[model samples]
Target: MFWASVGFVGCILISLGSNIVRKTVERILTAQVIIMWFILLICVFTLTSMNDWIKFFKSLVENFGKIPPDISWWTLASAVCFIGAGGISNIWYTFWIRDAGFGMGSLIGKIPGWRGKKTSIKLSGYLPKPTKENMRRVKSWISNLHKAFWLVFFLMNFLAISLFAVLSNVVLHRRNLVPSGFEIAVVQAEIFQSVAGRFGYFIFLFMIAMLLWGTQLSICEGIVRQLADTTYLVSRKVRKFVKRDIRKWYFYLFILFAVWGMVWIVLQEFFSELIKPDFFLFLSANIGLISQLISLVMLLYFQYFIARKYLPKRLWDIYKPHPIRTVILLLTACFWGYFVGMAWMEKLGLLS
Candidate 1:
C-alpha cells in the first residue's frame, strides 16, 4: 500500500520542487515502491528460504555508509504537530461554514422579498435540493469525540516512537544514546553470520525501504497536487495548462525517486564489507514518520481552508455513533501513535 501510494504521489509532483534533495528524495521513493514490491511479491510467492534471501541480499551491497538513521518517534512527534495544528482546525472551519448558511436580517429580508421573483427564476430547477440523510451522517461523523481520536493518535505515536528509541538504545548501548553509523553497521553485520540470515534480513529491509519510499511519495505528491489545485482555484485561467501538463510531471517524478532509491540500494550492495551488523532502525523510522506527520498536519489544514471551498456538500458523512466514533478514531489514532511513539520514547528514557 505504501509503495503504491508513493509511486502514485511521485508521478504527480516530479516537476514542482526544484531543490535537489527534495526532488531526489521524492524520486527515490517512487522507484523503491515499484521495485521493492515486485521483488518482495516474487519472494513471498516463491517460498524462497529465508537464509538464501539474506545471503543473496548481501551479495548486492557495495559502499553503505552515508545516511543517519533515526527512530520513528521523531517523525511521530512531527506528525502530531501537523494534525493538532491543522487537521482539527480545518474540521472546525467546515462545520462553521455549514452553520453560517444564508443570513437573516430585516433589510436583507426585504431584498429577498424584492428579489424573490428574480431569485426564483435564477434558481429554478438549476440546482439539486439539499437532502437530510447526508446532513445526518455528517453531523454524526464530525464530533468532539473524533477530535479526541486525532489527539490520541498523535499522543500514541509519540509514545510508541519514544518507547522504541529508548529500548533500542538500552538493548544496544551503554551510554543510552543511539549508536553511530559504524556501530550500526557492526550490529547489522550479525545478519551476515549466515548467508541465509543475511539474505532474509535484506529482503525484509528491502520491503520496508520500499514502504518508506511510498510514505514519502504520498506526502510529496500531496503537496504537488494541492499546490496545483490551489493555483487553479486562485485563478481558473491557469487550470487548462496545469491540468494538461501536471499528470505527466507527477508520474515522471515518482519514476525519478524510484531510480534514486535503487541507486542508493545498489551502492549499498556494492560495499557490504565495511558495514557491521548493528544498525539504528529507529532513525530510518523517524525519517519516514517526518513525512507522515507533515501530511497529517497539511491534510487537516487543507480540509478546513482551501479544500472546503472545493468540497461541495457531500463531505458531512460523519454518521458513526459517538461511542463508535470515539472507538474507531481512538483505535486508529492510538494504534499508529503507540506504534510510532514507542520507538521515540524508548530512545529518550520516556517510556518502558
Candidate 2:
C-alpha cells in the first residue's frame, strides 16, 4: 500500500514533467530509435535463412509440442495483455491520476475537512496551488524527467513487447497432440476463404469486436489515454505531438494500434500448434512478472527523487524514515530484483 501510493505520485509527476525542452528532444529521439530497431527486426526476420529458421522452429515445436495446452493458454494470454499495453496505455494512465489530483499530503489533508470538493481542468480545484519556485523547479525537472523516462519507457517497451510477442507465440505452439498449428491457420484462412468460413470466424470475431469497443474497454482506454498524454501536454514540445495528431491524432493512433492487435492474434494462430509450446508460455509468464518488477523498481526510484526535491523541510521531518522501515524497503527491492533478474538470465539460457 505504501509503495503503491508512492508509485502513483511518481507517475503523476513524470506525466507533468514532460513539459521540459530537453525531454522533448529525448523522447523524440527515443521513438525514432525504437522504430528503427523494429524496421531492422523486420529485415532480419525476413532475411534470415528460412531453411535454418524452419529447422529451429521445427525442433522447438517437437520439444515443446510435448506440453499440455491447459496451462500454456492462461500464461500466454496474460503476458501479452500485460506488455502489449505498455507504451500505449501507460501514457493514458497518467491523465487518470492527474485528473484525480496531485500533492498527496495536501489532497489527503483536505479530504477530512471538505466533503464535496471536485476538480477539473477548467475548474482548477483538483490541481495543487502552485508557488512560483515549486512551479519553476517542477517544470524544469519534469521536462528532463519526461524525456528521460519516456526514452526509457519507449526503449523498455521495445524490449518488453518483443519479449511478450515471442513468448506468447512460442507458448501456444506445443499445446497438444492435435496439430493446432496448421489447423488454427486453416480455421482463420477459412474465415476469409468462403461463406461458412466468413460467418464462422469473422462474425464471431466481429462479435468479439463489439466487446472490444464496449464500455469496459472504453473506460479503461479513457483513463489510460488521459494519463499517458499528460506528460506530452505539459512538455515544451507539446506542439509536436499536437501537430502530429492535430485533430487529436492520438485517438486515431489508439484505434490503429487496437486493430493491429489482430495481426498478433493471427500470428499466434499460425504458430500455436507447434512442438515445445511450453517454452514460450513459460517465457510469457516470466516476462510479465519481470515487467511488473521493473515497474516497481522504476516507481521507487522516481518517488525517491521527487521527495528529495519537492518535500518541504518541516514535512520531511514529519515523514522521516525509521530505521526498520529503511531496512524493509531495501530488502523488498533486493528480493524482487533478484527474482526478475534470475528469470531474465534463465531466458538467455544462462542458468544451471
Candidate 3:
C-alpha cells in the first residue's frame, strides 16, 4: 500500500509538472511505452518456455470449453471490451491528438499551464474557408493521422497485449496460478525471476513501476483536458468561471480529481465492501461497452454523413474509408453490440 501510494503521488507530480508542456508529457509517455516494449521483448525471449506454449495451444484445442468456474462471464466480457482501446480510454487519443496540434486542432490555441508561455489564437472555433489548397492540406493531415493511428495506437497495443497473453499462458496458467488484486504485478514479476534469477525480479518490478507511473500521469492529464474542454464547449456560464484560460480550469479539475482519487484510495476497503461485486463488474464491462458502441456510431456517422457531405469531392475521394474498411467497421460494431446486449440481459436476470 505504501509503495502504491508513493507511485501514485509520483505520477501525479509528474503529471502536474508536465501538464503545461504538452511535448514533455508526450515524450515521457512515449519513452516509457518504448521501454516497456523492450522489457516485454526481453521477457519473451528469456523467460517463456516453449513447452508451455505447446501446452497452452493444446489446452485451447482440447479443452476450449473449460473456463475456470471462479471466473465469471463479466470478467471475460470486460477484457474483451477493452481490446484495442474499445473503452473510454479510446477517447483520450482524440484529446492527445488535438492538443498535439493536429488538423483543426492547429487552429485552436493550447492551454499553456505553468511551464509554457500562454498562446492565443484569433479564431477559436472558426476554420478558414475551404480552398483547393486547404482541402489538400486537410487530406494530407488525415493521411498522416491514419498512419499514426495504425503505428502508434493499433500496432503497439496489439503487440503489448499479445506479449502479456503469451506470458500469462506460459508462465502463470501452467502452474494454475491466477493473478488477483495485489498479486497481479507480483505474478508478472515472478515470470522474470523464474528465468533470470532475483535480479530479473527487480528489473521487472522497475518496469512495472515505470509503466504504472506513465499510465497514471497520462490518465490524469487526459481526464483534466477532456473535462476542461467539454466544460468550455458546453456551457457559457461555466466558461465564464475560467475566464477563457483553459489552464486554470485544467488545474482546478486536476486538483479535484487528485483529491477524489486519494479519498477513494484511503477508503477503498470500506467502498469495496459496500459495493456489490456484480455492480462493479457491471460498471466495468457495460459502461465501457456502451461507450465503445457510442464511439462507433459517431465514427460511422462522421465518415458516412458529415465527412462525405462537407469535404471537397477530390479530398473526399482521397480520404474516405474504402468499402471493405467500412464493412469491417460495421461488422465489428455489431459483434460488440451483440455481446453488450447479451451481457445486459443477463445482468437484468432476463437471460440465463
Candidate 4:
C-alpha cells in the first residue's frame, strides 16, 4: 500500500508537469515490455523443464473440460468483458497520436502546460488536402502505427499471458496449488524464484512495480486528455471559456479525478461490503461490455458512413478499412453483445 501510494502520487505529479506524457509513457512502457520479455524468455528456458511442458500440454488435452467448471460463467464473462473494454480503449490511440503531434495531429497542436508555450494548443480543424504525396505520407504513418501496436501491445500481451499460463501449469498445477487473494502475486513470483532464487524474486517485484507505475501514469494522462478533448469538441460554451488552453481544463479534470479516486480509495471497503464484490464486478463488467459494444458500433459507422462520405475519393484506397476488417469488427461486437445480454439476464435473475 505504501509503494502503491508513492507510485500513484508520483504519476499525478509527473502528469501535472508533463504535456508530452504520451511520449514519456511510451518510453517507460517500452522498457518495461523489454524487461518482461527478457524475464519470460529466461523462465521458459531455465525454469520450465521439458517434462513440465509435456505434462502441461497433456493436462490441457485431457482435463480441459474439468477446468474452471461450468459454474464459473460469470468469471468467463468478466474476462470477455475486460477484453472488450481494452479493445474500446484502443480508440484513445488517435487522441494520443494527435497529442504527440504525429501526422495531422501536428496541425491540431497540443496542450502546453509546464512544458512551455511551444506546446500550447491551437484551435483549428484544418486537414491536409489529399495530394498523392500527402496520401503516401498518411499511409506510411498509419502503417507504422499498426506495426507499433502489434509489436508493443499485441506481442507483449500475448507473451505475458502465455508465460503466466505456462508457469501456472508447470509450477502450481503440478502441486495442486491454486493462488487466491494476496497469495496470487506470491505464487506468480515463485515461477521466477524457482529458477533464479532471490534475485529472480527481486526482478519479479521490480517488474510488477514498473508495470503498475507505467499503467497508472498512462491512464491518468490519457483520461485527462480524453475528457478535455471531448468537452471542447462537444460544448461551445466550455470551449470559449477555456479558449485554446486545453491544459487548463486538463488540470482541472486531473484534480477532480484525483479527489474522486482518493475518496473511492478511502471508502472502498465500505462500498465493497455494501455491494457484494461479485455484484460490483458484475455491474462494472456490464457497463464495460455495453460501452464496448456502443464504441464498436460507432467505430463501424464512422468507418463506413462518415469516412466514406467526407474523406476524399482519391484517399479512399489509402484510408478505407478493408471489408474483412469491417466484418471482423461486426462479429466481435456481436460476440460481446451476446455475452452482455446474458450478463444482464443473469443480474435480473432471469438466467443462471
Against the true structure, candidate 2 reaches a TM-score of: 0.38
lDDT tens digits by residue: candidate 3, 1-352: 4665675576556655764546778888889988887887888888667875676567667976555665555665677676776577778777777777888786677766565554443224545456878778877888898898898778988778767778777777768887776587898787668778998898888888887777667767777777877886777775677666666667778778877766666666467787554555457667788788888889999988998998667767766888998998899788778778767776678866
Estimate TM-scores for all models.
Answer: 0.35, 0.38, 0.85, 0.86
- Tens-digit lDDT track of model 4 for 231-344: 876777876776656667777787787766556555655676764545655566667778878999998888888878987787777888888888988898988888777767
In model 2, which runs have C-alpha deviations exceeding 4 angstroms? 1-95, 101-227, 230-238, 241-249, 270-285, 315-329
Query: What's the TM for model 4?
Result: 0.86
Q: What's the distance in Å from true for residue 213, model 2?
A: 10
List residue ranges in candidate 4 displaced over 4 A.
50-68, 83-87, 118-124, 190-195, 269-272, 275-282
Best by TM-score: 4
List the pairs of residues colliding in candidate 4. none
lDDT, model 3: 0.73
lDDT of 4 at 264: 57
- Give RMSD to native, each candidate: 15.8, 18.1, 3.3, 3.2
**Ranking of candidates on TM-score, top first:** 4, 3, 2, 1
lDDT of 4 at 333: 92
- Cα deviation at 210, candidate 1, in Å, is 3.0
Off by more than 4 A, model 3: 49-71, 119-132, 270-272, 275-282, 311-315
lDDT of 4: 0.71
- Give me candidate 1's TM-score against the actual structure: 0.35
